[model samples]
Target: MRIKLTYESLDGDIILPKHYNYHIQALIYKTFTPDLATKLHNVGFPLGKRRFKLFTFSRILEKGIPTKDNEKLIFKRKITIYFSSPIEDIVGNLAERSFKEREFKLCNKKIYISQLEIVTTPKIENKVIIKALSPITIYSTLYKKDGEKIVHYYKPIDKEFSKLIEKNAKKKYHLLYGKDAEQMSLEIKPLKFSVQENLKIIKFKDTIIEGYTGIYELLGDPELIYLTYETGLGNKNSAGFGMWEIWRGKESDEDA
Candidate 1:
């Protein structure tokens, strides 16, 4: 894990431990989004590149002979921002400096407010994937609690219901795990079955209510099941929303 330290203002200056490496500093900056990205770019900081050096390590044996082979130690470049005040203040001052075409005063020196560092590892981008599963007709009932306020209840079609009702009942199912397949095949199951339920409601001082409730169910083979769920809620502050999620199963004991 990477750690970041930001001070509001400098009553006194601060120093970093000599042992800390540049790569660690870079990792800290990577945790934030556009703020750091834009700043680094504006300062002409190099991107998608890194620098490092190699050192050799050796082990000595009891017989005074070198036993273990020499190993290489590598270092890379990273960037760290040091400020006399809190992070918020540092960001503000940096912005002000940028707008005024002036440099920020730090550590008793005028600096550009950004630093370049060397790290041991390369940076990676984050990826997200979204998939759709089978759809089912939702049987819902609405009740009014007050003016312009309503609650909805949904349940699965009874097994003994008419064929038409059964055919229309929403087909609920879980997502199954697969490896790199472009298309997925889903097996629908009963929507009423769920392994867990989570519910929360928040009421603001202005009497605006907002909440969320969700249910999860597992499907597929025991060794590679998919989990699925539906969630939604709303109040005076905003209209409620509902969504579904499905994902592959955790590794089995055999894999562990």
Candidate 2:
């Protein structure tokens, strides 16, 4: 399930740090009951030895001007965000709590829920085009001979990019359904992308992340495609990377 949330600032403008993923993440956790919040935070849904949070959210959708030497973003009154999860409890808890509370603090700025609605699921086919709402990231952590840890971020065209994403999605399927899916192949191919324009660098708390934003064609089983829609694509989903929506090519322009 998915939900869209629109927030309006009670103050004249909403000001926030340039890298505010942590703040938004914190706000989402706060919307849950204390016990639920603690469990989701400390111990997520377990599948084998690994635990999955099973939730992902898009980056804030708003126009804002950077100020104070690019340290902060100042937005006029309102912002919108999309959150998704296959787990009904996670999605339901967020919507119910936000509606009941109505008001909350984001980056210490007073704000109220101006709008909240469940987003209808689109018909996901075995093959479809998608555009990233947040950058999709795939990486490997390697330790050097000198005992130095290095994060190697991959471009969408890299072989490991598709391999890792397909692997990740299968794991999600197994975790969600508690059974293995039938053997099938999944492929993600970039459609519209530019290295200079689409490369994104983000800082979440103290960690620097490299990711990419663009349109891509996903070819796979329909079930896996739908799972990707709800749980997001690639890696670091809970930290606000890899949320995407379907793009209907020329139809999108016509609709706009």
Candidate 3:
């Protein structure tokens, strides 16, 4: 349910906003059937609740590091996308419409689909460790001094972190599946992490949230784990947050 994509600048140069992750996600949805695309795009549909969405993605990468050449910034050759929904429509939709040499708009700039590769990650086990392929953003209500309410555009590890992740992960599971998700014995503990700060789209506006790219220990139902894998671990997943990959090992091991 994941794909590695390589796009080349159709015009030999392309420019994107520094916070361009959401744009790439949109292009992917537009490649699907019109109705599905509309469904995916209408984030507020279904009674103003996103109850029928699935999938996540990794960061759009550039070769080594991005280099600025005057007004244009050069990017890497490849980026990746992941889909967790087992719905045939999404898979079939993309397969039918993914035409080679197709053009896409990222941050209103043009790029051609150069290469596409499907990748498979390990299935959820009774207990497994997961690492973030992209940063994760959660929506939580926290109170500050004088009872000020804080919207978690980005939340640090707090008493509510574990509870929020579990709550949201289960809620997404129910959204994808009609029945209530079978909450297994689970502990969402952040073992290792590095702060990932960035801009995210909320109500079509730029917002700063404290997101993190890191690893967590999961002990729960296999289905729950798989659902998290497909849809992402936190909110705004459909908008490019909370995608995960299996931890290979220490960076020095160069595990492949």
For candidate 1, write residues 58-112 as lDDT tens digits: 0100112122442212111112322111123333433443434423333232333
Output the worst ten-in-a-row residue range by lDDT, candidate 2.
Answer: 247-256
Between candidates 2 and 3, the lDDT winner: 2
The TM-score of candidate 3 is 0.78
- lDDT of each model, Cα atoms only? 0.24, 0.87, 0.63
lDDT of 2 by residue, 163-229 (tens): 9899889999988887786595578999888767788888998899988888889999999988989
Report RMSD (Å) for each prediction in the order shown: 21.0, 2.3, 4.2
After aligning candidate 1 to the native by TM-score, how far in Å is the CA of 63 from where it should be?
Answer: 54
The candidate maximizing lDDT is 2
TM-scores of all models? 0.19, 0.94, 0.78
Better of 1 and 2 by TM-score: 2
Give the runs in model 3 whose Cα sits over 4 Å from its true position.
Answer: 43-52, 63-73, 77-84, 142-149, 153-156, 195-204, 252-256
